[model samples]
Target: VAEWYALVAAPGAMEAREPLRDLRGALRAMLARVRGGRRDRVGLGRAEPTLRWLRSLSAFTEGEPGEGREPFELPRFWDALDQTFKVTSQEATKLSLAFSRPPLTSAEDCRKLSEDVQNAILAVATVYYWLPKGQGTTLRKMVRDATTEVVKGMIQLTETILSAPLESLSQEQLISTGGVWEACEQVSNLPRDNQAAVASALAACLGVVKDALEEMEHALVEGQDPYSDIVEDEELGFRGNRDTYWSEADRKLLSSCMGLMKASKACLKKVLAVVKAYGKADSPEQIAQLDDLADIANEISPSVDELALSMYPPMNQLAVRLNAAKLASVLKKVLEITKTSHVCPPSEEGWVQFLTGAVDHNMNKIKNFTQGQL
Candidate 1:
């Protein structure tokens, strides 16, 4: 297509329009033939077999015990799998992007990339057979499901290159290629077991709380908005000649809120440590309890964010008071749930009590700040 357009646009091409038309038709037909040509030596276009073979391997080893190879530890195995997926996904994207840019990748080079892509995904599938059979059915199933997503994405991306145009990367090709990276990303979040799931949920919550804490900290401590360094929250709607400002009263209120945010952060961090040390999911009831615990912990970050944001310029004392009440309730509830949950044992009860007392103290301090006391 590119060659035909170049030839037609050349000067005096109108004098040779018939030959130009012929060239265009021939080029179009040639493109079709090339697209429909015999499958490459590596089975690039005829990829159903490769995908089916990988899926069958997953099914075959779904129940089989590991015997031939020294099985990798689940965490190590998972991490290795993630790295492989990322590298393979990057390679596949690189090929597509190379063709999209100038000096397009050659057919031979594309074949080589496709072969590498296929081999990488095959390696991922084959590892399951070598995985330890002692893995719990749930964890195993989760692993296989995530693995299947990656394999499915890999096959889709590889197959897309077969029909890709030589001129530029098409939208369909971009989506197909992106599917692999998206699936690879999910692998990072894949939990090893239910215990890890609970911890992940809390860890994610802690991450959000930390972000809010940092943004407020940056604004208060460094006097710079982390998100928009030059723009003040007060000037968001109406720009002004006045410089960005945060009054001392607002600072003190934000400071007190930060105190509560810090308390929430510490409480979650300590609870997460306990969860890692004592959390159990051996039984059905225990598993359900952990899930409930995770859900409760997930509530802290958003409340922390809401209360913290209310402390921005022209601070709404009413909104601050309301959000503070909500955060205090959430923290107390999380602490209460952690106290009776499987993650919290009788031995850790004293530690939890101390943690609860710390939360109460911070909550009271914030309460006083919002109420205009020292």
Candidate 2:
């Protein structure tokens, strides 16, 4: 009867509480039958005590292995051989302490019982440490839990860009794909006087893409077990119904962050093409147009910041977040490279070097961001 209860209490042991409760009742009846001479009828000692011993052993083994292993007991016949084959370093000391008194044989059982008690105590402590720090802080706890999902999104986006083909993309396909290119063109085509409108539309698109990327990356980064922090709030602890709601909340947050990243990447690529084209111009009016490209680059700064903010746990360092700002600075440098070429160095080779550094520095930044380091 106790062995049956042991099986039921094991992690993920019974499919439902109803099964466990039913099993418990059945076990109690079996114990009553054993005490009522049913086992003697079968010519074996009453099974109640033996069953209880096995159950005690089962409880002693939980979480100690740190890996998957079934809960079971060895026959007492093998106990001596098992002890001889592998006496642990502490076994002698443990045995000596157990045999220190008249009831010394009970020492081993007492040690196992002590271990079982310690395991149970530690389990509760682990859960308490993960829980919200204060009373009525359920919302804050939820947000902290949700942040893991957000970081997963950013990690996914980084992988996507890392694996992106370096080969040049088709201009026609880029524009028609309704991704970053299309969004960029839309921003560019707006009336010159409506700079605010252009910024708004670009910003909105960037926002969606950046958010989506963050969520997608976060999903790929993996998460700690949600039940790890679960503690018994007495009757309030069994809120299993909240699982779906919490999962849905995670999905929404991840989706929003990924979308924002996607849009930002697209718009930035389009703005880069425009900058490259404008950089080749010789007239003062054309050179002044570079300022507009710089303005667009500045607008994308928030999305970069968002991406960095979402990469956590792995890339919690400020240097990692600063890479995005460095990329933006590099883009600005590209513009300045074009602007100052005729004035300072007075040589085309010097300008070429500046352009080379712009590309090389930004590429390094991308590499660091993708690797979740700085």
Candidate 3:
């Protein structure tokens, strides 16, 4: 307010003051709501549009400024940006935490927070005016990334609330609350905005796949369970022996399992490379596709972990087969998504096909081993 008033004498500076003032008012309103918010209810339909819009804005930020650029500069914008972000973060924390107690956060309180969110959106959009003409893409991306997290966090919290029965708190609700906070906490750390963050995240997924692969390799090469070292000796008598060594059955099933895991790791590696290097986040649909790829890749690691954990002595072949099938299913979903997303364009399609073949072959081998066809 002081900054704007100070510049009031300057020509054309008057126009920026009202939105800036409105932003201040919105934050204050949100602050009050956080201090004593009520319970709430909302649908999923309201949330998806924000996600889609942010993705579109993300692409808009990436483009050449062209003729859409506007004027009216603001000084010390980072200080203001940080302040609004802090308030918005607090609001998200309060709303998400509210969901933890009896009675969900109220629709009205959400609307209050949303006012702040919108103002915060306006606050960051000021980056266009903050930077001299040709605001570096970095700041613009920061705007989009920060806004995306805030929007997505709120939507996630709302979705969690909507799905949970009002009669009682559910595990999904608790888990999603933590997720919302974790995401909100990452706002300051979105290095180069959503693109870079997605790349870094996909890289993390790749690392997890590698870890799972190495774990299986140890199980294969050492002929021992990789997750534990304490060896349980085989019972010699009629009590159904608990063998310390891999049964001929174990080795065959594990060998095929390892093959499938290797294929999984390779598929992830190839997909990560494609997304990091060439995935187009240039449109809402494109960005949503990238998100789907990330989501499906994330799903792969947990399945691999489950399969690896089940590979120990007294191994349940059914469990192993089930896990492998789940992984293959997720892999297939990745292919389904890649058919349209930039992650597997025509040029990259061949490797996906090869990986698909590997997954299927290894999968069949495991089925054969599990079925006593070995």
What local distance difference test score does each model get?
0.64, 0.36, 0.59
Q: What order do candidates take by lDDT, descending? A: 1, 3, 2
Model 3 worst lDDT run, 10 consecutive residues: 35-44
Write down the worst ten-residue block by lDDT for model 1: 15-24
Error of 3 at 322 (Å): 1.0
Q: Give the winner by TM-score.
A: 1
Residues 1-374, model 1: lDDT tens digits: 87786464433333222222222232222222222322223322334544453454444354454544564466677767777777767876775675565454554555465556555655665554455434444345456676677756655654455445543678978998788788878877778777776777778788888888888888777664334434555746633422464555656666667777887888789888987999876776677677767777878988988887777766776688788778878888888888888777788888678767876776676677667532
The best candidate in terms of lDDT: 1
Residue pairs clashing, model 3: 38-106, 39-104, 39-105, 39-106, 40-104, 40-105, 40-106
Residue-wise lDDT of candidate 2 within 279-355, one digit each (tens)?
A: 33334344334434444455455545555455432333344335444544544554454445332233334444554
TM-score of each: 0.54, 0.23, 0.51
**Per-prediction CA RMSD (Å):** 12.1, 30.0, 14.6
- Kindly give the number of clashing pairs for every candidate: 0, 35, 7
Q: Evaluate residue 264 in candidate 3 and report its C-alpha lDDT on the 0 to 100 scale.
A: 75
